[model samples]
Target: MTIKVLVADDHAAVRAGIVLILDGAADLEVVGEAADGEQAVAMARELRPDVVVMDIRMPRLDGISATRELAGVTDVLILTTFDIDEYVFGALRAGAAGFLLKNTDADGLVGAVRLVARGDGMISPGVTRKLISAFAAQPAREPSTRDLSVLTAREQEVLACIARGLSNAEIAGELDMAEATTKTHVSRVLGKLGLKSRVQAAIFYSESG
Candidate 1:
């Protein structure tokens, strides 16, 4: 199935480049483009694309706020030049499905869009360590109040792999299970934890420690 996408960035040149890259892929199509956060949200609601490739800083709403508005409406993939902890954490907290740096190659960009479209998640490899560290520095939650005992052993293992930023295929390989099974475990883990995405699952795992 062709994955429809909406590209949103204030820079016309950068937005064009992303559109070009995404349109080059056989399974991906650029349905629309937005020049600012407000426009992004408006276009997103109208077009209802599978994914929205968003920039963090825009004139009106900012990507985080737009992301917050679009939550449950469509998945958002934040592609921006900024890799600061504030943007990273803010984007994830705003319900972005993926966060990637603008420096990402064409293939990486396409892969991130596809991943988010399919309900998986991605974070730029360069910022993954920083993201983990930021999460770790947050105050730990009380173990008794925030129990993970509800997850099965396999589900807990899946959550751990997610916290380590492993893809479903990687988690499957690590656990000696099929990729489909890994996806199942991931879904179960998120459902049991009452989390929205793998990003949140990772945060929960980090704060649990």
Candidate 2:
């Protein structure tokens, strides 16, 4: 199935570049473009694209806030030049399905959109380790009120692998299970934890520690 996408960036040139690359992919289509956060939200609600490629520092709402507003509406992929802790944490907390640096290559950009559209999460490889370490170093937040006990033992193992940033195939290999089984465990874990995506599950595990 073709994945519809909305590109949002304040810079016209940058927005055009993103649209060009996404439109190049056979399975991806650029349905619309937005120049700012408000426009992004408006377009997203109207177009209901599979993914929205967003920039952080727009004039009106900012990507994080727009992401917050878009939480259950559509998945968001934050593609921005900033890799600072604030933006990274902010976007994820705001419910972005993926976070990527603007320096990412065309293929990486295409891959990230596809991954988010598949209900998975992607963080730029360059920033993933640092983001996890920083999150671990911060004083632990209050324990999650969500009950992890609801998950089966296998599902718990899957959650741990997610916190370690393992892909579905890696989790399957690690646990000596099939990849399809791993995906089922992952879906159950998220559903039981009341989480939106793998990224949120990872954060929950971190906060629970």
Candidate 3:
């Protein structure tokens, strides 16, 4: 299936570059381009693309807010040059399905888009460790016992793996399970916690810790 995508960035060059790369992929099509976040949100609402490749620092709205607006409507894959912890945390909490650095290679970018389009999640491997460290200093909020109680022991282990920024393959290897089984556990955890994406599941686990 061709995954329709919208490219949003403040820089024309960056947008063009991303569009060029995505256009080369047979299964990924560039549906629109936005110079700023407000335009991104509006165009996304209109186009209803399968995914949006977003930049965090735009003129009017910023990608974090734009992602929030597009939540439940279209998946957002955040692609920004900045890897600051705050931006990472903000985008994840705002419901982005994937976070990638602008410097990512063409194959990685395409793979990430496909991942989110297929109802999965990813964070650039380069920043995954940094994400964990940032969460370490964050204060835990009061957790919903009723929500967390629904998880089985193995599902709870899977939640911790996600909170540690491990992907399904990594979690599967670490926990001695099949990758498909791990994905199931991740989905179950999200459903039970009432979270929309794996990023939120990670944040929820960290905040509840």
Best by TM-score: 2
Query: What local lDDT does model 1 show for residue 161?
Result: 95
Candidate 3: list runs displaced more than 4 Å: 138-144, 149-192, 206-209
lDDT by residue (1-209, candidate 2, tens digit) is 99999999999999999999999999999999999999999999999999999999999889999999998799999999989989988888888889999999999999999988866789998779877688768885788645887888788889999988788878889999988788788878877887767899888887786
lDDT for 188 in candidate 2 is: 85
lDDT of 3 at 7: 96
Q: What is the lDDT of residue 112 in candidate 3?
A: 94
Ordered by lDDT, highest first, the candidates read 2, 1, 3
Q: What are the clashing pairs of model 2?
A: none
Q: Comparing candidate 1 with candidate 3, which one achieves the higher lDDT?
A: 1
On a 0 to 1 TM-score scale, where does candidate 3 land against the true structure?
Answer: 0.78
Candidate 1 local distance difference test against the native: 0.89
Choose the strongest candidate by lDDT. 2
Q: Please give, for residues 1-209, the per-residue lDDT of candidate 3 as tens digits.
A: 79999999999987898999999999999999999999999999999999999999999999999999987788899999989988988898888999999899999999999988866787898778887777666676676656678899999999988877677888999999998898788878877887768888877776675
Q: Which 10 successive residues of model 2 have the least lDDT summed?
A: 140-149
Residue-level error in angstroms, candidate 2, position 190: 3.5
Task: Give per-residue CA lDDT, model 1, range 62-147, as digits (tens).
Answer: 99999999977888999999998889888988888899999999999999998988668988887888976765676766654256
lDDT values, one for every candidate: 0.89, 0.90, 0.88
